[model samples]
Target: MTSFGIATAPQQVEYADVLRVWREADEVPEIEHAWLFDHLLPIAGDPDGPIFEGWTLLSALAARTRRLRLGLLVTSNRFRPPAMLAKIATTVDAVSGGRLDFGIGVGSRPSHPLARREYAAHGLPFHDTGRATDSLDEALTVIERLWTEDAPFDFHGEYVHLDGAYGNPKPARRPPIMIGGRARATLRVVAKHADLWNIPGGDLADCVARSRMLDDYCAEIGRDPAAITRSLHLGVSYDAPEATREAIDAAVAAGFSHIVLGLPAPWPGGVARWVADELVNRSPAHRGT
Candidate 1:
């Protein structure tokens, strides 16, 4: 089934406003998933606005909604240590009744001003993507082992080191781990590890091209390309909702099974309703059998 979901940009909205969106979603049975971004602050524009923490917001939302699968689009590995992150995902998944999608990324763009500000605020030394990806390799290693292993173990890596690590209360179900990226190095990580590969903001042909590149990586790694679900994050216009319909159809045609519709915060008037009535109806999974 082609699963469609909402991935909200929370920079412009407050806690209460976002809650309304979640409640609106609760009223719409067709909407399959609900998501947020793991941004310490806004990705762009004025960084002075209120930016809610992704995991905390998700934990709160978990208590409010039942059906919509929850996740951040791509959480940076630098935000939290690897072992802790795995435990957090485990706890949230248990609380949400196995509805978590563990979306993670290497890190944010080193050149981005907001990212730089965020790093400075958190006292995490900023590094280029190369170093970030290396750390991410180690981080994912720890996360997966902790999530699945039955006994305590030690993790030794260049960037991360741990001993007697145990992720208790293992999730009732294993949530799909989505690695989000576009570059070749990141794609290799996705090929080797990701349960779902999410590529954010790209045209149709670009997505097809990237998918092929990921396929190449899978082949080189002696892995099946089909093992990983391909997901696309597309910016949508609720005003011209037809454009969204076309984009969703095009993305599905291009071999993306999971479609994440990204909406600007302070939602455009009637957008949520339009999504429920129009966009969700486009999904065969949402339609009548």
Candidate 2:
């Protein structure tokens, strides 16, 4: 059975409002996961717009919701050091009773001023895509080792390094590590390290093709393709004439185990209600009464 999830643009709404909406959604049986977008600055044209820190908000969400799994839709590798990021994730997992999923990708919001500043601050080779991919590979290794190993795992890579560093109180559950991106280098990283794959900016056929590639890579590496969960990040607009119910049905049929509905800009109150009614209420699997 397909699991339906929600991905909200928290920066567009107040933190209190987001917490309320998430709590309500958690009570709704249809919703399985609640995702938040991560960006150093607003992705839209507003440089002075309000933006909440992704990790901090997620840590709060972990405490507020009971049944819903929480995570960033995708975190930028440029935002924090890999070891620190892993530690933060572990703490969030412990607080949430092991309901966290770590979704990560190479930087995407370079157009934002703060994001550009972050790139500069880190001295990240943003101009060189190859260098960025290499950095991501190193970061992924550090994150995974931190979560799994009790003894300090020494990692000496081109971009990241660790020497007899210890990570304690591992997560109650080994929260799934999801890698996002459709590019070849990104997919290779997913094949090598990710327990889940989140595909964005693609149609069903494109997603299917990418899924096949992931499976092929898994086979090449002697890993089981079925072990990796496949998901899609959908840009959903309630105003569209297309029925939301049909859209969800199509998504499930297309093999998306998780559907992360992208909130429209300017978080309209009715959008959440509409999703609860038209999508969650109408679904036979989640109708409360």
Candidate 3:
């Protein structure tokens, strides 16, 4: 069955509005999970628009909601050291009673000028995709060890180095890892580490091709391709429900089972239930309901 989720990017949106939508979604069985993005600056709207920090906002949302599993859509490995991120994720997992899906990836690429500016604004070094992917590979290794290892350990990687690293109170349960990206290098990492792999929806053929590459990578590693859930992030259309439903149908038909509807900001009242009825229920996957 296809599981549905909602992603509310914090850019140009009010905290109360996001909270309200999440609270409503918590009561709706159709929406099983929720997500926030990790950009420090507004990628959309005015340059000076207010944008909340993703992990901090996620922690607050975790405390306020009961049923929804939540996490950032994809945390930037460049933003924080892996050890610190692991600790932060552990706290959120404990707060949400072990309902975190740890989504992470290489930070925004240099190709996106808007996204690129934020790194300079925040005094973060924006490395090339090669270096970024290398860092992400190391970050995942360090994060996993921190989450599951019994004793404090040291890691000395090219990008991340840890000395006597340990998580005192681990997550209520270790959260599943969700890695988002469509690049081949990222897919290699996804095949080895991720419990779920996510890519933005638009080019169905491109996404299927990427999935196939991931399958080949998995096979090379002697791991089952089915081990990772294929996830898609399709933008929700407030005015065109049929378009969103068509995208959902196409994604599920291509073997993508985990769907995340990206809701636009300044969310309308009762938007979660609206999404459930207008998009999810109307999709071919939910026909005969």
Q: State how far residue 221 of model 3 sits from its true place (Å).
A: 0.6
lDDT of 1 by residue, 52-133 (tens): 8899898888888887888888888988999999988998898788999999998788767777688888788887788889
Between candidates 1 and 3, name the one with more favorable TM-score.
3
Candidate 2 on 1-289: residue-level lDDT in tens?
6677888876646787778778877887667788887775666546557778888999998888889988998888867788999899999999899999988887674454556664554465454557667788899888878888878767888888888866788988788888888888888888888988898745778888888898898898899988888888777666762465666656666666667777665565655566767776675434422
Candidate order by TM-score, highest to lowest? 3, 1, 2
Q: Of 1 and 3, which scores higher on lDDT?
A: 3
Q: What is the TM-score of each candidate against the true structure?
A: 0.94, 0.88, 0.98
Q: Is candidate 1 or candidate 2 better by lDDT?
A: 1
lDDT string, candidate 3, 64-181, tens digits: 9999999998999989988999999999999898999999999897788999998889898888899999889999998898889999999998988889999878877768999999
lDDT of 1 at 67: 79
lDDT of 1 at 1: 70
Error of 2 at 59 (Å): 0.5
Model 1 TM-score, 2 decimals: 0.94
Cα RMSD to the true fold for all candidates: 1.9, 3.0, 1.1
* Candidate 2 worst ten-residue window by lDDT: 280-289
